[model samples]
Target: MKIKANLQNLQKLLPSSWLEKLQYIHSILLFRWILHGRSQPLACNQKSAMVFSPHQDDETLGCGGMIAQKREQGTQVVVVFVTDGQGSGGLETSRDKIIQIRKQEALTALSILGVAPSEIHFLQKTDGRLQELSSQEQQQTIKQIAELIKYYQPEEIYVPHRKDCHRDHEATYQLVKLAIFQCGIKVELLQYPIWLFWRAPLFILLKLQDITAAYHLSITSVQEKKARAIASYSSQIQSLPRDFIKHFLGAYEIFFNAEL
Candidate 1:
């Protein structure tokens, strides 16, 4: 019954037919085994880390359990949300109202994940339009991110994977890369994939060499906390497909090492 309900939600949100969805699931399963066999258990040893999210709920979706565990270990985790989150609102809702709602939701979610409000940073960049930024605007965004890196001086950084199949995610990765370069900081970059499971092209999936090198972090101890944190994103829970939510609540979180 639960699976059926989630599939119904997915059908409404995605244009793909049932057959296509099944194919996607098959690919995900095959890749999951490959990743599992090759992955090493990730350690929560960093004293400080920065997580860059393309939107409000992405941090929770991608690495909420990791964040919870890191906080438990007394690691300073800074979450940076790159967009205003206004793009998720319905047409009937006012832009400002939705943004405020998303911001509050983010606060509630992060709080559940043990992130202090002071440690959260919202860049307020226009959502869904990161690819359309002017050169000057891009430079400014890069500078802002660089400044944040300088301020945090984290030993590690997390961002969406380059092939996550979302434009915003891709743009965020590029911007963060540039920011690291501009700041001349040497931090381990861990890329988390949100859309790749369902949206990545076959060619990307065929990159076994790269995909197999991914790391898996066990969240068994903090799975409850992660679920609570994910639940706090009420807006997203009610809007996005339920299966998407379920996928994040898995026993482990996967992260790819930066392709330096």
Candidate 2:
């Protein structure tokens, strides 16, 4: 009780901006401590795993470490790019050219992670407009996703958390959720956070109930490979802030068992 009171008094004495900075620092330290010394082996062994990315770089940004670890365990890792990723570049760039570059970059990134070209799938949906699709288009896309799921019969699936701020990420989550339901397949669903952390407060993240099922895959040994894979997305890195790169290169990758 005394410690709590002292902390309160200290907070009251600090300026608001300083308090905010301290809060951010505390959050980072807490997150690192939670991840530290909790590293474990890859969750799936010798089973096929698939990742659904809203764009080319998301798979690497959100779950590259896990993906690399799975592949190292002889798991067949498949990456499905849900959108063309043309929206990442400025309007001045040619959309077709951007799409081509992004696809090639994805291939390079996945190759560094031990994924083969044959395992990569592209939905070819229009970027930044996935959520605006007509009912018919939406159904078609869902059916296509279901078909791939059925064909791959992956034992584990990775997708972005539904609460992610990006519309395409949310739409990809919905589509993947529906596809799994339509396929009537029982697969382990692991959700990763990308833009969600950027928008949510540190205190709110700390209070998330989903953290109970969350686990971290140790990527310390493969951190260099993961960094190279992320760097493959040159088109994206050109626009994104440098700090964003640190999130993926952390000692471990976090995953939550999402129920949908």
For each candidate, what TM-score against the reference? 0.88, 0.83
Q: Which residue pairs clash within candidate 1?
A: none
User: Which residue window of length 10 is worst by lDDT in model 1?
Assistant: 198-207
> Backbone clashes per model, in order?
0, 0
Model 2 RMSD in Å is 6.1
Cα error, residue 96 of model 2, in Å, equals 0.7
Q: lDDT score, residue 260, model 2?
A: 57
Q: Compared with the true structure, what per-residue lDDT tens digits does model 1 show for residues 141-243? A: 9999999999999998999988777899999999999999999988889999787776524433446655656888889999999899889888878877666
Q: Where in model 1 is the C-alpha error above 4 Å?
A: 1-24, 27-31, 89-91, 203-206, 209-212
lDDT of model 1, residue 124: 96
Q: Which of the numbered candidates is closest to the native, going by highest lDDT?
A: 1
In Å, residue 99's CA in model 1 sits off its true spot by 0.6
